[model samples]
Target: MAVTLADYEKVVGPEVMDEIRTLAGYVRHKSLQNINSTPVGGGVAEILTRMIPLLRELGVDATWDVIKGNEAFYAVTKAFHNALHGHPETITPKMLEVFRENTAMNLEEMKLEGDVLFIHDPQPAGLIDKKPTIGRQWIWRCHIDVSNPDPAVWEFLRPWVERYDAAVFSMPDFAREMPIPQFRIAPSIDPLSDKNRDLEPEVVRGVLERFGIDPERPVLTQISRFDRLKDPLGVIESYRMVRRHCDCQLVLAGGGADDDPEGAEVLREVEEAAAKDPDIHVLLLPPFSDLEINALVRGSTIVFQKSIREGFGLTVSEGLWKGKPVIGGAVGGIRLQIINGVTGFLIHSPEGAANRAVELLSNPELCRKLGENGQRYVRENFLITRHVKDYLLLMLALDHPGERVVRLAGI
Candidate 1:
């Protein structure tokens, strides 16, 4: 069943719904087409899946399209992804050639038809080349932490990125010193979505039992793709460290994106590291397993997003929304989500994560306080309604470039 604005109203309230509708009215005439590498897996696709429907419900013409990529092309993009996250990956000339060829192929096949062409991440950023000829407002939304991206990779993509009318990033620090206008629009989660929606105690317990996780035992989970940047191995290490003091189970659960070719290899590595521990349940969940994921997070005593690098970890917010005190690495968007001792604890090492995990597990009162604070924080800042408002405001701002105040009629 398609979710309506009324459905979201129940989660975000009337004031927020009213604001979204008002903003949508300003840009309803303009068509929005979101282009990314994969239509499944990763936060970008998950967000667009939930967002587009709501945008259209508000009378805005919104559509989504995915750029096609082969295995080799995806491998190159995966390397680019790692490098953009500040990982040391050698960018070969052949890799650059592979990217260009695949992007060019997509460019020829895709229609540049939207009034606002929203290109997401570096994968389909090359699509911006047609902006001049198509005469449309192109906005490159970078969903990665490129503040310290590999010089070679950044240089290669910088020219293409600068051709856009404006650029949007998850954080101000992720922004580059580009000529185009830059905006910081944080990513958000749909509170009403299957992944974050409220679940019955029985349903949560059943899902846990099915996964062989004991409901009585304290559950520590990290729901993300099996990528090195997410540091699945490090998460296991943290679980082992916590095991010495606490009698708890760790759930490392996630699914791979179609655009990410390195998932299988990383999964194998994680499995091998977790094989010795019976309590460490490594799950490679299939796509659209939002209900299971929701159960895993909701059932867990504590949530972990021990990412070495991240582009605004949505899972952190998802955990927080479920009222779980998330212990995340002090990096990238995780920094923005976890407010040290307020919402959740921010850790730099597996030892640090484990230390926090034991503390929270032992003290139920502190956990409840942090969880309550985290949930309220997410409601105030990081929900789908707020995300839509930012985009709508940006579209309106584009109409009056360089203006200090964007005066919308009848507001």
Candidate 2:
């Protein structure tokens, strides 16, 4: 069932509905074009899938565009992703040429239109080179932890980034000390999406059975792409640590994106790590397995996101939105989602994560309290409604530069 804006009022409160109506009214006819690397797998695509329609339904002319890139392009972009996240990497001149060539191909082929163009992440950041000709307000929405980016890669990408009218970072810490205006807008999760919606008990059971997960034991699950940064191996290690005390089953399930070339390699490593533990189930979900992901999260005794570095942990938000107590790494946007002992626990080490997971699994009341608090946290802040409203307000601010207060809608 498609979730209408009215669903948000019931979940979040009518304040969100009134805000949406008012903010949307100002930008009802304004066109928005969202360009990103893939139309599947990652959070950017997932958010856009739900967000574009909701924006259109609310009277904004929002459109989504996926930038086409070949395997070589994705390979280079993967390296860029690593470097942006402060990982040590080597980007040769050849890789630079390939990235530039691919960007040129896209620029020539893709239609550049809309009053506002939102280029998501580093993959499609170069689209702004055409801004002079496209004559639209280009906003660079970077969903990566570029707090300490590799100098070489940053230098290469910085010039292109400077071309944008404004930039958005998931957390204030993720922002680079550049001249452009930066906004700290955290990413959100849709409560009504297939990945976070309410599920029937039988549906959850069937999914668990199909994946060979035994619901008889406590289930610890982590839903994320098979990325090294997500620390799938570390999650396995943490689960092993917790398993020493609790007889719980661990399930690692996530889909790979077209832009992430290292997914298969990481999956193999994760598979090998779980080889000796029959209790550990490794499920490689295909791109469109939102409901399956939702079921796994819903059925989990404890949900975790042990990312080494993250832009903003949307999966954590998704779990929190589902009223599940989450244990996320104390980094990036995960910190913003978990209020430490209130909503969920955020830890720095695998041992800390395991200890907390065991603690949460043992105490049902604490778990319920954490989950309830998390849901309310998501309701008040991280939802597509708030994201859209922020964009609308930003658009008005951009359109009228000197206006201190752009009344988005007349109450």
Best candidate (score: lDDT): 1
Candidate 2, after superposition: displacement of residue 405 in Å? Answer: 4.7
lDDT of 1 by residue, 1-411 (tens): 878999989988999999888888889999999999898777798899999998888888999999999999998998998898788998999999999999899989998789999999999999988876788898999988898999999999999999988999999998899999999999999999888889999999999999999999999999988988899999899888888898999999998766556888899899999888889899999877999999999999999999987778888999999999999999888999999999999999999999999999999999999999999999989999899999999888788888888666694
Relative to the true structure, how large is the alpha-carbon lDDT of every model? 0.91, 0.87
Q: Which stretches of model 1 miss by more than 4 angstroms?
A: 70-72, 256-277
Q: Residue-wise lDDT of candidate 2 within 158-264, one digit each (tens)?
A: 99999898899888898888887888787887888787878999999998988988877889999988998899999998998998888899999988666456898
Stretches of model 2 off by over 4 angstroms after superposition: 256-273, 402-411
Looking at model 2, the pairs that clash are none
RMSD value for candidate 2: 2.7
Worst 10 residues of 1 by lDDT: 255-264
lDDT at residue 108 of model 1 (Cα atoms) = 95
What lDDT does model 1 reach?
0.91
